[model samples]
Target: MPEIKKYLSIVALGENRDKLARDLVGAIARRGCEVNECRITPLGDHFSAAMLLAGNWSAMGKMESALPGLAEHLGLAIQFQHARPAEPQTDFRPYAAEVVAPQQPRLLGELLDFFTEQETNVVEVSSQAYDSGLTGAAMCTLHMALQVPVNHHPQTLRDAFMDVCDDLHADGLLDPIKT
Candidate 1:
């Protein structure tokens, strides 16, 4: 198999996060590339992300072509490149995920603590879950950098996260892991 690691950076702004993710994934999938993970960074100005994908070189080309239109639609600059491989391989498959949790209407000390303890860096987080008419909640997006080891069944990560949530009393709404 020809293994390769591709790094794609996408910038999308606005309060509508669902739309941004949907557009990016849709555009990329249409090109035959599967997004392995997206780490969104909220830096007070805009949304930035480093996405990892696995697919053939042809899919990479298709994604590159469609990125510009998506960027324009979201009003953000898009920069992408492939990771330097020490050896030739088909594509890179990583174990990662984007988890969203709903915090209490009160302060987010507990929620923030979970991110810190888990070592899952926060790319971007919002304290406005209720702004869209949902119940009072704060949401965070974590980008897990370390991929799962190749030879063992995955454990430790999710349980650790759940332990944190249990201590902090935060409710996790979405926890779909890509392992």
Candidate 2:
């Protein structure tokens, strides 16, 4: 039997600065942990990141023990939890959903609710609001990575999704993710 590798899920927030990413990744490398997946971005004046670290039991423990000191030294707010590898989902197909529209309250919530009603699994979501350069109108854009069940007909789902977008006064697209 293969040994089960340990995993750690970490989220950190700190004031944006140079060398922060290098320092954080270096710390993980020094402790012998490998970053399996990560998303780092600047949000306003702060830098935020979420990472999944993988390693053997000893390496995981070492990294976990060092987190508090690292957080203090870097002036970051850090949180971590034990995690397990995601099980393969052969019955699901990857898809991407994109929406762009005039900014409106509850727009994101309504879109999320629609997906929830269909029992679709939303794996990742990113959204931003800005003023359109042409019209100087407030606008919002949302992109989501989804694991859609194969049992749902793609055409049917796309049609339904389009209807929801029309009702929300948003332009949207739902399509398969190209590798």
lDDT of 1 by residue, 60-178 (tens): 77777877777777766777766533352223224444444553443356545654665444434444333324654455434343333344233565676566656555443324346
C-alpha local distance difference test of each model: 0.55, 0.94
Which pairs, if any, clash in model 2? none
Using Cα atoms with residue i matched to residue i, what is each candidate's TM-score against the true structure?
Answer: 0.41, 0.96
Residue pairs in candidate 1 whose N, alpha carbon or C atoms collide under 3 angstroms:
1-90, 2-89, 2-90, 2-91, 3-89, 3-90, 3-91, 4-91, 41-123
Worst 10 residues of 2 by lDDT: 1-10
Query: How well does model 2 score by local distance difference test?
Result: 0.94
How far is each candidate from the true structure, as Cα RMSD in Å? Answer: 8.6, 1.3
RMSD of 1: 8.6
- Report model 2's TM-score to 2 decimal places: 0.96
| Model 2 Cα shift for residue 103 (angstroms) | 1.1
